[model samples]
Target: MSSSLAQKLETRAKSLGFDVVRFTNANLPELTGARLQAFVEAEWHGDMAWMPETLTRRKTPTAMWDGAVSAIVLATNYGPEVDPLERLTNKTTGNISVYALNRDYHDVVKGKLKQLAGWFASQSGQEVKV
Candidate 1:
């Protein structure tokens, strides 16, 4: 069952031009989650309410949602031709986080996630009405 699902996922990913695909458990690592929760409790994430919500989810992804099978962490490298830090010297203008200066990544990455979800549903024979 796992082999066929993996094969189908790979094939669908290739068709959608994905570089790689992998599966993960819903439950995050215990030590990592505990440390994250501790960090949140310490108020290290000042002014970020999302951090607490993330901590709650990290405590256990499975508890957050039923039938949650995997978590996809995707990153794209927009290689800077020159030193991005050089721009910081000219403090006259605003210096956005290097990545946010450009296009919205959620738009770019969500399409890939949608494609993967489609393939997974199809391969698994699960009715993905969503």
Candidate 2:
């Protein structure tokens, strides 16, 4: 198979602070798409109405937005000073999402992304938006 867009983006994305990078074709392969279809057909989404409503978009991100040439999914260290995973085992209290252990990542990550995208925009003339 040909190298994926992620692979092509990896070299530059790594320079942008990604320690690890991988690429899959934006187009879903039949086998994987069939698996996703099976999951939906089996009613696994339950109360997640949006999951069903956006099934096609989730399966193919291009449907979510036009001219969606790339998906730069960034993973970062949102953990606390300690091994936060330990807290989840207690079950004595409510279980929090691992990523939500700290401040709301949406605000933090989006702010940081805007900053970086701002810098990129300064360098290039593209208008940046989420």
Candidate 3:
């Protein structure tokens, strides 16, 4: 990706509430696949059965989609602005986790992702799989 395009994507992602945006080659390392296998074999994911089911595809982006050349990862902080530990001792009022108190982030994020994907396709003149 061009530096200018990367900057634009980063800026747009930030405007859409993404705290962190990064771009990486789609082909993941062998170590990643090995680690994922280890994680699944150890049964550390608990009730998330999808993790093991999708293990083969999750090992690498290319395994899931052959045409994918790059990956844009976005992350946001869902933690509360105030100290959550302080609320542990306060039994008078109910304390809710910051993420749980707000509207479902999935909806918000999906909308933003669509917007971002549209913008990216327009800018890069490339098809966005998502």
Candidate 4:
């Protein structure tokens, strides 16, 4: 992708409230898949049964869809203004993670991603999947 297109995508993502936006190819290193397999075999994933269930597809973007050639990564920050550790020290006050203090980020970020994906597909005339 051209630098101009990337910049436009970044701008659009930020407008949709994403704190960070990055672009990368769909391909992943073989070690990534190997590490995931090792982690799953070791039962390190805990209760996230979906991790193992989707292991094959999660190995690489292309593994899920062969047509995938690129990826648009987005991130949102939910850091607390005060140190989370400080809250932990105060036993009287219940310690709630910053993420829990606000609306569910899974819903929020997923909504934003879908909107961004729609806009990108319209602007670039390319199919997008959230």
Worst 10 residues of 4 by lDDT: 78-87
Worst 10 residues of 1 by lDDT: 71-80
**Tens digit of lDDT per residue, candidate 3, span 1-130?**
8999999999998998889999888988899899999999999999999999999889987878888888999998766677888988988998787678777888877888999999999999988866
TM-score of 4: 0.86
> Best candidate, lDDT-wise?
3
Model 2: lDDT of residue 37:
74
Please identify model 3 stretches exceeding 4 Å from their true place: none
Look at candidate 1 and tell me the lDDT of residue 113.
68
Minimal lDDT window, size 10, model 3: 76-85
What residue pairs are clashing in model 2?
Answer: none
Sort by lDDT, top down from the best? 3, 4, 1, 2
Compute each candidate's TM-score over C-alphas.
Answer: 0.64, 0.54, 0.86, 0.86
Worst 10 residues of 2 by lDDT: 1-10
Clashing pairs for predicted structure model 4, backbone only: none
Model 1: per-residue Cα lDDT over 80-130, one tens digit each: 567889998997997778777766766656776687778777678764321
> What would the per-residue lDDT of candidate 4 be over residues 1-94, giving only the tens digit for each residue?
7798789999989998889998889988999989989999999999999999999988887888888999988888856667778778777888
- List the global CA lDDT of all models: 0.70, 0.64, 0.88, 0.87
Per-residue lDDT of 108 in model 2? 74
Candidate 4 lDDT for residue 38: 95
Comparison by TM-score, 1 against 4, better one: 4
Q: Alpha carbon lDDT of residue 96, candidate 3?
A: 81
Q: For model 2, what is the C-alpha lDDT against the true structure?
A: 0.64
After best superposition, candidate 3 residue 88: deviation in angstroms?
A: 2.8
Judged by TM-score relative to the true structure, which candidate is superior, 1 or 3?
Answer: 3
